[model samples]
Target: MQKRAVSGVGLGLRSVHYDHVLSRRPAVPWFEVISENFMGPRGGSGGRPLEVLAKVRREYPVALHGVSLSIGSTDPLDFDYLKKLESLASVIEPWIVTDHLCWTGAHGKNLHDLLPLPYTEEAARHVAGRIEKVQDAIGRSIAIENVSSYLSYKHDEMAEWEFIARIVKTTGCGVLLDVNNIHVSAINHGFDGEEYLAGIPVAAVRQMHLAGYSEENGFLIDTHDHPVSDPVWKLYAAAVRRFGAVPTLIEWDEHIPSFARLQKEAAKAKEVQDGVCAAAV
Candidate 1:
């Protein structure tokens, strides 16, 4: 299978590692940035954040990953947010743009967390229609990422993977399959991870994510603080096998580590990909 603009494994571009990335320009294949961070106050040149993003763009292909799209909210879409997002996309010209399939909040208030939705036919149609509008606004198809959930709604009608497959089928959008999230949710909700993998559409996956999690009371929390867990790494290998080496990213968000250590995590992902692809060949 042919990969997207970015191949191999990439790292999340956090502010802490700005100098190392700017000065050293490490061997990382690509970098993903939080879209809101560089959205830049409407009219300004985006000040320092935009400047740094410009510098990074010159060196590597950047993917704009967002946390605030709230694609599944019951409330109407936020035009202002879309305007800023569109402006950012214009400036960055990101290789890909993505946000969580879950909603953030409703009624004009922001909860600021990626909350899960009820997996129903109504939700499927609602979110798909919203995604089509979002695609029209952005002038491009954005990938929707599946989030790890600690709870489920009583009204859900299908599995999470089935819901995802429905969205992509309707909107023609891509999927950012987060392997670590599947590991976390499978443990929390007691579902078979392999079955979830088999349920998703293969060609819809445009990217994959691997991150660390914290376990408490036998429930896995999607905390990107620790290194990628052993089970998640195993799941990632399975994903590469099923998806044929799609562009994967190593995400470490909180309690950021040194650049060298971060690179080591990305390197480990690449090593796993190489092994999987080699064996398949």
Candidate 2:
């Protein structure tokens, strides 16, 4: 599959904005849709969602962001889900296909959450092999995202960032660096967000995510409902300084906002990207 360049700030394509996007053709550089939303018993074919998606595709580049790859799971690879994913990718011709680095299920049962993995050499080797196979199954290299964690394993041999860097290094896959997740995990786990960013290989960073987080009893949660927080914007600046102007997305999932509101958030990101790129020059 040929690579489609997806740069600039974008928004998570939600159903509420379908009319606005199709009618107004809002000036979004690209939009990413949850791969599962468009997949079903039909195997990535049919449905009004697709008709709308196809229409949107004619205007802007699209990316398939998945939540259930479970790349780190001990269960055997889910070829069925992968086939559906491949089918969806073929239909959408997305610029990028990405899922989280954390495992979503184990023992053939999905917990429906981004579960943390042990940061061990053995685990890193385990995930790298799965990523290589996934690339083969989909016939296109995909990026793995860093998910926020509320807990850590006592047996972890290295930091979360180190584990991620090793997987990309071994599989030659790209990284979808989520700036909000880093800050949330940092505050929740007591790690330095900057150090995490520094550990990731710069050139492998294919995309970036900015989102709002919530707090519950002193623990930070990776909820995408609110506006992007102050610290996340600061972390994003640091990311742009290191990774250059990589493609970015503002994710507002729970509390759906107006299309114009999403545009403003994306505009802020563009503004930040511009500032960082100019200062680096």
Candidate 3:
């Protein structure tokens, strides 16, 4: 099998290492930014962080990953939020814009958490419609990522894979295919990981996410605070085999290590992806 070309690995862009990244312009292929971070200039742009992002964006490919958006929410779409997103997108010229498939809140309240939506036809229509609106506002296609959850709904009308498949199919949105999330949700919901991999339409997956998690009280929390665990690595290997070498990223939000350490994690993901392509070939 021909080895797939492994797209380079990157870290989530955080404020802590802005100076280091801008100064060094490290060897990572790209950086994934949280959309809300650079949306507005609360303290004005003369400061260091904005300057650093601007410099880094010029030097490296940047992708915007949002936690908010609440795509699956029952509330009305926030046009103002979409405006902010569009402004940021214009500034960074990100390679892609993406967020969780789950809703953060309903009504006006910001729950500040990625809460799962029931796997139902209603949710499929609701979320997909919002995604379509977002894409329209932003004038481009965006990716939706699978989120880890500790619970499932009793009123679910379909399997998680089926729900996601339909959403992407209907909205023409890309899939992020977070491997660690697949492993986490599979463990929580007692589903087969391989089946989940096989279920997703491979062509719709434009990118991938690999991160660390912790088991607490019989549940997996996406801490992203440590190294990628062995099981998650195996799962990621399976994903690379299925999806070929897509843009993969290593996320470490809390207790982030030094820039060199994060680069090591990205290197590991690249190595595994290369191995999969080699084996498949």
Candidate 4:
């Protein structure tokens, strides 16, 4: 049997320079689209993004990266939100669909952020149950990502990696291992990044996210608003060494750079991945 194609370094699909992407059509292995942006028919500004996405989907394989799954919330699973996701998946036919493991909001209020979940058995069970229901509803497996957190929950009973491993075991879901986020959390919480990477089940990882961050008051934030930092690059190098070049992405949500600049970042990831592949030989 032939080996399955995995995702390599790619960019987050943005509305800016949509034509440039289609025209130049750079050597992107796979593209990741924000799930909510393309979920439905557009009326005003919203529709154009989906139109471009449809064209891009025809050109390259796309993955779904969601911001608002709210997997950790105690509230009932939002079937309406998930049905929309299912509908969009049918249209775009993504390579993978994933969301953060943390909750976004509760009681119908949009917090507009990825809030960390308490690392306890209770939180694990709650998130795992939700992930199962979501996979069942979408008729596809989903990957969960570890978000960069500032503060740790005092009430939590376990480490982040332990919680993540348990969630994967219970739900049988894959992981979108963000190397940058792990580094950020490790630096903020004072843990070994290598240990965090080693604790994860390598076979469970389907994709990886590498992005830049900002520091404030001796804490690292997953800003995704700047270029890839040297520390993150070091971590990325380590990740490919450990995980064998899992599909990686360069995410820049703010201070958006030109497509050429983003592709440069992709090349960096490719360089590291190639170095790893070479070392194994």
Candidate 5:
């Protein structure tokens, strides 16, 4: 297994704060970037974004988080996309590479959304096989994150946590546990977030994601627009206790805030992490 290079808390690197981060060089341990944004024709090594990313990388570790891997789709694996992703990885050498467990498209059509998959034995085997192939293609293991869902399939034979656990056991891939996603999914589908946490194998989790969500018409949306909710912070505390200081990140994608605001939010995660570590001792 690859050693974890990132620790403590981190903030997602947004283009809005590129200048601030590059100029000031904040003390963030690492930054997670959307993989697709940097896969330019030149493999992103020569683009302006790549130049900025190179500067950030000189100061901090980076992780590649992707949204369009489509590992769960029935369509044939897109080797061309995988090749480009491999090239980007070669340049960046991210501490970790990851994508969502849900499928984003099907039948050569880009649906442009992280669609949920059926939680069944067959689905688990299929996704795990694809992940294995992806690892071989990239020449390294990758983490898979869970997506928040508003609906469930009637044919699901297992719980969401069970599905993820099975995938990890089968593929030997790490888990990027998204705390906000767990809370949103639990509330929307009527389950306990703590139960979900407990069901996951602690050793399989390599990283954790903390973000904010919004409520609309009684359903909680994974908006990542506001501050981390109090409830999600509590869940994060639980996760820290269970996982023992896994690399954590604060994700704020929409309504991008000032670099200072983002740093303040990251500071909160650091506070929680320090408190948890102290209590553990």
Candidate 6:
């Protein structure tokens, strides 16, 4: 499939805002859709959701973000899932296809979580091999996103950033830098967020995710339920400075507000990006 360039600020295309987005045609430069939601029946085209997605695609660029690739799982890769994903990509023609770097489940059971992976060379190699297989199946490069974590592995051999960089280097996949996840992981693990950013290869970064997190019992949670916090906004500025106008998306999956509220958040991102670019001159 051909790649498209997604510029400016974008919004996650939630069902709640379908009417508003399709009718009003908001100022969003692009929209990202969850891949699994549009996978229709076997040997068939996507259903109503895909129809709506096509409408949105007509007005803005779209990117496919997935949650269940299970790239880090021990089980054999799911060719069925990959086939569906490829079919969706063939239709959407997204700028990029992306999923979390962490695994979802194994043993034929869907864990329904973006579980962390061991930051070891062996683990990196294993996941990189899986990523390559995924890219080959999809017929294009896919970006792997860093996920937030509340725990660390005892057998980890390197820092999270190092592991991610090594995977990108080995597999030639792009990085979807989620600034909120970096901040949440940094706060939970007591690491410097800027240092994490510094360790990553900036050129591999293809897109960015900006979302809000909640604090509970002195621990931060990657709950995409609220507005972008001030600290996340600041980190996003740093990301824009480093990545130079990468496509950024506002992800509010839980307690989703009205379309206008989400558009306001996208506007805020554009404002911050504009300020950062202007100051660089």
- Summarize candidate 1's per-residue lDDT along 101-208 as a digit string, tens digits: 999999878899999999999999999999999999988999999999999988999999999999999999999999999999999999999899999999999999
Would you give me the overall lDDT of model 4?
Answer: 0.87
Q: Write the per-residue lDDT of candidate 6 for residues 195-253, one digit (tens) a residue.
A: 89888898999999999999999899999999999988988898888888888999999
TM-score of each: 0.97, 0.97, 0.94, 0.94, 0.96, 0.96
State candidate 6's TM-score: 0.96
Error of 2 at 174 (Å): 0.2
lDDT of model number 6: 0.91
* Whole-model lDDT per candidate: 0.92, 0.92, 0.86, 0.87, 0.91, 0.91
Task: Provide the lDDT at 65 for model 1.
Answer: 98
- The predicted structure with the larger lDDT, 4 or 5, is 5
Estimate, for each residue in 1-281, the C-alpha lDDT of model 4 and write its tens digit: 11236567888888786878899898888788788877654433337777788888887888899998999987788888888888788877788999998989888787979998999998998898889999999999999999998889889898899999999999899999998999999999888888888888888988899999999888898989988889888888887887888888999988889988999999998999998889889
Q: Residue 13 error for model 6, in Å?
A: 0.3
For candidate 2, the 10 contiguous residues with the lowest summed lDDT are 39-48
Instruction: Please give the TM-score that candidate 4 achieves against the real structure.
Output: 0.94
lDDT pick, better of 2 and 4: 2
How much is the lDDT of residue 203 in candidate 6? 96
Clashes of each: 0, 0, 1, 1, 0, 0
lDDT of 1 at 233: 91
lDDT score at residue 60, model 6, on the 0-100 scale: 82
Report the candidate with higher TM-score, 3 versus 6.
6
